[model samples]
Target: MNFTPALPKPFTEIWREAYRYNEKDSPRKSSYQAPGKTPVPFILGTTKLTGGFSVDTSEYPTMGYWSNVPRNEKPQTLLVTGYLRGDNYIKERNTLIESLRILTSDEDPGYLELPLWGRFPVIVTNWDVSESGGKNGQCEVSIGLTRTGMPELQRRDTTGVMGLFNKLENTADSLKDAAVLAFESAVDGINAPDTIADSFTQIKTSLLDIAGRIQGSRSSLNEITGGLSSITNLLAQGERNPRKLASALFDSGKQIVDGIIKIRDTFDDPELFFTIKDNVKNMLQQLLGVKNFFLDVDTVTIKQQVIKEEAERLFKITAFSAASQLMTKLEDPTFSQINSYWKLLQDLEGSINMDDTNIYTAVQEIFMTVAEELSSKNIAAELTTFIKTPIPLPFLAQMLSCDEKKLRRLNNFSDSFLVEGEVIYV
Candidate 1:
């Protein structure tokens, strides 16, 4: 089967248009209506929120054959409600809004009150913006949607994406690890809960290791995703029919969830987990490929082109200037001190090489000598920070440098404290 992912339109073209839009050159300028010639103000309000059902949970043990088994912990609700803003935007901003009464008028009566997608609560009217800053006095109306919508819409979009893959992967990983821990706990006669709790230490380290690997693999996919999020927001801003895009994204999310569910079902068995992991990885690969294809269109071409180009130019200039400054400071005292040891170490390392047999023999002899010296000492034999020196001269030199010779001489200086002792060697 052909495995090629679909590519969006060219990034350069989209970037060019995006650049123009950002310059504020495309939008129609608002008419300067003369004083005292006030247009009809738009009314902004929300529809009455109807009754809705929500799920709640409580812990309970499994019964009958699984009577001793603990209750499984999980999220209480699968879906939430209340987010409709169709009419509220238009009614609040009469100046920018051409179809002010479309959602609430007789032609579209009850549309404002309907739950968006049988879920989101729709706004019944325009927003109250007298509190929002304007040149006109109080009671004067403001036109257009607020800036807040962008972030809110993005939150929903990204949350959906995360829900599809992130939640599934996390849940799958947890279930797999938990099952293994439970089995081990049973074998070792330990409580399942205690084993699970102990497993967290290893689990935390494993997660950190995975995150480190991912960062190394592609230089932080999370950052890449965040940049893509901005592009998605920009697309949403000028979109004439946002619902179409939202629908497409949501459908894609559903497909991801279906794939995850399959993985979940197979997680218990090792062979199956490996198979499912491979398939899930393939899905992610496809998703990333699709995203990259769209990103080029979204970033390099459209209305955002100028911003991208400017940002690139600024970055190059900044990087070159920083490099030049670093070159100027390369010979500074601080740099010299920091790098001097590094060069010495490199030369030291380059000059040192040993044959395998000689290296092993030398290490063994050193260790044997250390053991012999430690055995001869009457002091307690404990491994501590004070490792015994392999060479007697170096040890004596180090001690002398630290004024240890003076301290030893002081200990032997007093005739009364000397106790007429004779010199002895071990």
Candidate 2:
């Protein structure tokens, strides 16, 4: 057999010795003595096998034993470390945890696969069976991979580790890309005058809304990492446990697809998907309310009647002057940075001629057109898609809303825009 045995040694004690002397920076040299010095078996030592596999040992400080190894039981704990070049440590740990947690007991332990030195693999165990009689008996039991039933375990674990590593690396790269893209998008939004309205208060509110939406999107993207981790572990065993593997893969895929659906759904129902949309709508409504109040003001008409001695009181309010002041406030450099529409406000006021009915109508139309232009394009498109294709209420309502009545409406709206949110006339 390729495996060799050095001598009978306490597994835990040998592991301790390995740590003290085997470290790269250590000056201590280990020598074997018949009785006084620790004598460990070759299998217990860090053994480099052919085919790029190495089995090793490590020792962690143990907790107080509930009951000591129990009367010559030699119930020892050794950190079994494995080093494999093209393997995944995290995946191995996860698989081993899943497969073996129900099987192994610390009080009377069994063997397990574990990481050593970053990517190394090791078998952990109590390593002694009193019933087996002697060290030879124990060593005999330890011989071959079948005893631990860990060859298949190793196969599964190796696949799992490699898959997990690749997935984690991919997720990390994706998150990095997301960060870069978000930054670029923000820069674009900041520079685009048409995207933001000029008015310090409005611009500030818009910036906050954009920031919130971007943050929400980033958070959604971050959730993919957990989903990916599950997929990696699940798919690694696709060849071994096709059914379970398929289930896991399916579940992960569903999560990603569901997230995309949520994206579409949230856009369609702005009030539901993002608080920012609600805030924007509210702000616009307030602006429209102000315009409506201005529209209601009574202006005196110029009239003269000789027979009836009709008289008219001329309300000489400089409407243009007040409008110019409003425009100037809107065009302030601070607000202009966010939006360019304030530059058109001057044209809006000049268009209003209270004396001419046609001019008055055109002026009001100009202002209304400018205000309507504030709808964000991206938000609008997402909303339109959401309105056309509503998400299933049974699936989404639990997370989106708690109101039963609203949930039903949301669900119905998904089927058809049988009901709609109000339209504010600018």
Candidate 3:
């Protein structure tokens, strides 16, 4: 075989041809960036990365080795190796060292980009630098990164996105006496036993107290309050009829939500929206907390139990209905809050028995409405975040580049206490 090595090529032309072939935007594989900061770019070498669905497993003592696995994932992490070298190796290395700053409570996370994998929002966990006097122009760095942003960028169609959430007819009537209808669905075919007439009488006081609380929510929403007083008369009608009592409580719940709606209708301030949501949430909690909702009877008969079950389920459905309605009226509620609200929806969904046609259908309608609302209103998902340990509100606000006062308005704090738990920022 005649070797083609007969033709010797100049190294300059060879290197130029290689560069011409590799000239494209994708040639650079890795970089780092902080919010509002320029990206720090560098060449990368071999990488050892570890990331996937995070899972928790529990080892159990059984004849067959088995582990309990929860349907949850831990945060993804990466072990990255890269290099920095040039004629000015020390300067380049120092520049990288400055770029990969130490992690701190108030520092915004930097992003890491890899060859094939997408860029990751990460806070540097730890890092090591390897150097030797002989290898003056080259050094290898290993870094650990815990990915952030569990509620990643929520992509949606922006075509004709305006008025998406507002498109729904403002028909609060669909929810009027929703509790009554839900309860009736439960006791529809099966008549309540005569012995059970006094079943939920114990909750009478709680119902009235909830109504009174709604009226006292604020003096500004006088229109909603004035109508709430009439619910007491409805309360008397409910005294003998558990369904009617639930309706009265529902009236209270609706009135509170309506008060929030009125506030949202009148004001554009985010604080007012969250304020109304917080107040209505309290009212709903009180209504849901009504004693004897599950019944106190020693032996719950099938008929009696059916009514009781309906009472419990519809009470939640009623409160959640009010919640879902109010959620639609909120302005930029944090995605973190939405996540918590989503969990509440899950609990409500679990409690509902599909066989109960009456209430199930009604509750499902509300579910669909809220799902749409979240899609339309999930604009602040990028702004939402959570912290494990306690951090000062001002510092947390600083980290998010948000105003401290505005942060307070965006989140519900029980008296400017420590801000250690889940936080939402608009």
Candidate 4:
């Protein structure tokens, strides 16, 4: 039989020496210590894990058991309770306070370091601090941290959408520039007869007013592109949002066409006492046609149509105005005196036509016919004998309602006719 040695009792000299430590040497050390010196266990106070399984239930008489549908796992909550007290309690307490402040801030998904569970991303939902006794600075802290799990990844195709918006903006700018150029060309081509100058001026003023209103609009893109404010209201509606910028461009273009049409219609009366050349009338009609194309056709097609129509319109107006001026010169009695009147009438009747090409050719022929008549007549001798005394030819022509150049040719006057004041016998 063997007998075991008796263990030393409490308060014995050997027990005190084995369990306690001197300032110089120690065999046992505490698990709770100053932070940074050693990692402490969370068990110094309490750590509670709170979570439960989540499921969905529905009543069905056919099945004996309730039908359960699987759902998301319930988030786990970690409740940490601890005390700050020791020789370095003040330092550790301050550090813990600062760390808690950071963890509880607006920063998303704060980090938690659990002694047994490792590190996790969490959100600090609640925190409480208490001092049971006064003046000792020993404090108890309770913190609640909720697990955040993994973050979701987002994917969107924004580049293509942004590119389309940019394209629309560029298209708007180009359309505005084109409209401005067209307007300027139309305005500059208005070589109105003296009888209709007032009416032409009124039309020009109205157009300029519209242009100014567009230029002064509040929207930057609209202002840059001369977009009317009235049309922008459509964009406020969600249904029309997709066409916002394109509609502005369309409206601006339409306004230009409408303005031109209005000018034409205002002077449309048969007995208006003034006449726009057939070509000028046709050009105005075609510009008006641009409104129809813009409204009915797609943007890609409409731009090309507008450009082609504008070029044709400018050409026709310019050519017709020039021809009308020449015709006015030949109508004077001075040039009429040299013509073979019957032959001239027959040639004119044969040349005139509904075809544009034929009409252009006829206009050229008329000019040539007049030139031939003047050259063949050799009226210099008659002109030389007709002038009696020096008189301002322009003033005389103005009084007679005839062209000054025709009067000068009739009296055989020189470029200094303004100073010569040569008068002619009508």
Best by TM-score: 3
Cα shift from native, residue 402, model 3 (Å): 2.8
Model 4 segments more than 4 A misplaced: 1-43, 61-64, 103-109, 134-137, 152-426
Can you write out model 3's per-residue Cα lDDT over 139-197, one digit (the tens) per residue? 88887777653222221332224334433322233443445665775676675544234
What C-alpha RMSD separates each model from the true structure? Answer: 31.3, 28.8, 17.9, 33.4
Model 3 misses residue 287 by how many Å? 6.4
Give residue 358's error in model 1 in angstroms: 58
Give candidate 3's whole-model lDDT: 0.57
Best by lDDT: 3
* Alpha-carbon local distance difference test for all models: 0.29, 0.29, 0.57, 0.41
Give residue 37's lDDT in candidate 2 (0 to 100): 20
What would the TM-scores of all predictions be?
A: 0.17, 0.18, 0.44, 0.25
Model 1 residue runs over 4 Å out of place are 1-100, 104-122, 125-163, 176-426
Deviation from native of the Cα of residue 195 in model 1, angstroms:
15
Candidate 2 lDDT over 162-228, as tens digits, reads 5443433333233223322332332332332211111212222322332233212555545644554
Quickly count the clashes in candidate 4.
4
lDDT of 4 by residue, 1-426 (tens): 111122113232464454345576553321222222232322236768787768755443333444453444677787878777766776766665555565432235555554344345556777776776674757787878776643332112332334333333343343334433443443343332221222222323332343443211133223423434433344333222212333343454444433333433443344432332232233333322222221121223443344334333322332222222222223233333433432433343333221233233333433444344344333432232234455576766676665576565455556555534444544
